[model samples]
Target: MPRGRGNRRQQDPIGGREQLPQWVRKEAQQPQRVVRNLRRRPPADADEEAPLEKRRRVDERQLVAMHPDVDFQKLLGGCDRLYKSKDLREPITIDILIRLNAALRHVCSSRYETIMFQTALNLAFAAFLRVSEFALSSNVIHEHVLHRRDVYIDHVKNQLFVTIKFSKTDQKGRSTTLVVDKNESNEICPLHSLKAFLQIRPGNDGPVLNKGL
Candidate 1:
């Protein structure tokens, strides 16, 4: 499903009409498909999937909406639980940051893209960020993902803060700030990497994570 991630409003305040992305509209307009090969009857239905317990049931519909992945699986769940619970995944830990940064830089098309990946990875880990906080999302609007203007760095404190202007959790549009301080080792340092990245900053046309690729 396409989600809004930038600051642009997708709906008129008074009209209440949805101004969804064209691609999302097109996708919704497309006919739904079913598998003729399936002989077994579906086990779950829509009503059963609602939030009856503390958490929504993980059924076929829920699984399909999950937008499957392996490393991410067991790590994340349905979007309805997005901000309700905290993420306690261990794989996106700092212990493997250096290795991940190295691998990203190894295959980047340019010095710009490499710096972006390194900076993004370090800041994300250090600040405990969600991808939707700074990356370009499906609709690229309404979700309020951070752009370059949202980042503030303190050279004296050796820290960088990301200002999230709005979010699903903060429907009132109240701003929240997340900080990433300097690491002892420059190899996996969010502060150091962020400074270096700003020195050779990439395109500022969109989301901070956008490489213009």
Candidate 2:
């Protein structure tokens, strides 16, 4: 079975007509596949797998060290503010989206296509509100899989989708989760909105969307 990422529906405020995109519909009708293929946890005394996790931890530590003044509290605070605001739209402009698409297009490989980049971007944005996260390090966001068997053996089959957790802060500095669902937790909710606004059609429009080969 493909990893189920769930579904999303858009409703017009004026006409109240609910709409679901074609890609979303297709994804619903078929099993969804993702690029990530790694075990969520290490096996018992697996010396070879230990090195990979160790390297990842070391890299994460180094990344944190490189930015000693990350101010995670501040970052979290900003995201909280955005989440609470009445504006349901995201702040990213079309220019930024276009630039990202262009860059991905330039580096297309024989194996990977634009949709992979698009979904990766979507997942990254879902995790972090800013595109800068992806721009800063595409490697971190890109989920690479060597083969189908690797995906299962690695225990990472179809785990590429992201989930958002909605929460609120109280005066006591404690946080309370309001909702935890895929549809509500979409970080690219704004970008998705913009895509809808532009009426982007699904076809061979360069980097916009590479639906099928």
Candidate 3:
């Protein structure tokens, strides 16, 4: 019995239990820390998007004014040639052209004539010169304006010819040569000449050339 009691006392264990108290005491003694982080603001570019986007959109007048290369005076000058001699000399200026354009706009039947004036100022003078070949159409006087190439073409060929496209017929995918030559060499008819001249005229108030004008 004494030996049994002595063995029981020796086998008793409290080492593992002692660790729990140490762990609890360490946890209670530790201080809690509060951490703070600074967040960066969003990029400054995001705030500027509205005004930047607004500036990208332009109105009609703004767009027109933006085209610095277009000459309104020269265009008016070309169109001025379509009128009678006395009227044609009225100075091929933008002011006169705008007035004439405005006046022509009122006449429904005169739509194409207004277009012719616009074309003179907007298109190359060589193009407007083609109108003279057609008798039915008003004569585009040489003094007001003349396209360089068209005049060159006339000088080179010694015949009147105008630049025009002919996709409807055999000249199929390419620009068809219209003969304005009085010599009747492969040139286009009077109607075609008129059509070609009118087709290339400028629709807006723009500059072209003063050539003879």
State TM-scores per candidate.
0.54, 0.21, 0.20
Clashes of 1: 4
What are the lDDT scores of the predictions, listed in order? Answer: 0.73, 0.43, 0.41
Positional deviation of residue 36's Cα in model 1 after best superposition, in angstroms: 20
Per-residue lDDT tens digits of candidate 3, residues 1-213?
Answer: 544322332322655332334445588889854334337433445445666666667764675688767775677688887663663444355455446446655763555554544434323232333333321223443322233243323445455454443222423435444444332311222333334443454542222222111
- Ten contiguous residues minimizing lDDT sum, candidate 2: 145-154
Give me the candidate number with maximum TM-score. 1
Best by lDDT: 1
Model 2, residue 157: C-alpha shift (Å):
24
Residue-level lDDT tens digits of model 2 in 1-213: 433444456686789987666677787999644436475554536456787676666654676777897976688799999888586775655456556756776787732454455544554444443342223234422222111111111113312322111112222323221211233323333244323322443442222223344
- State the displacement of the C-alpha of residue 35, model 3, in Å, after optimal TM-score superposition: 99
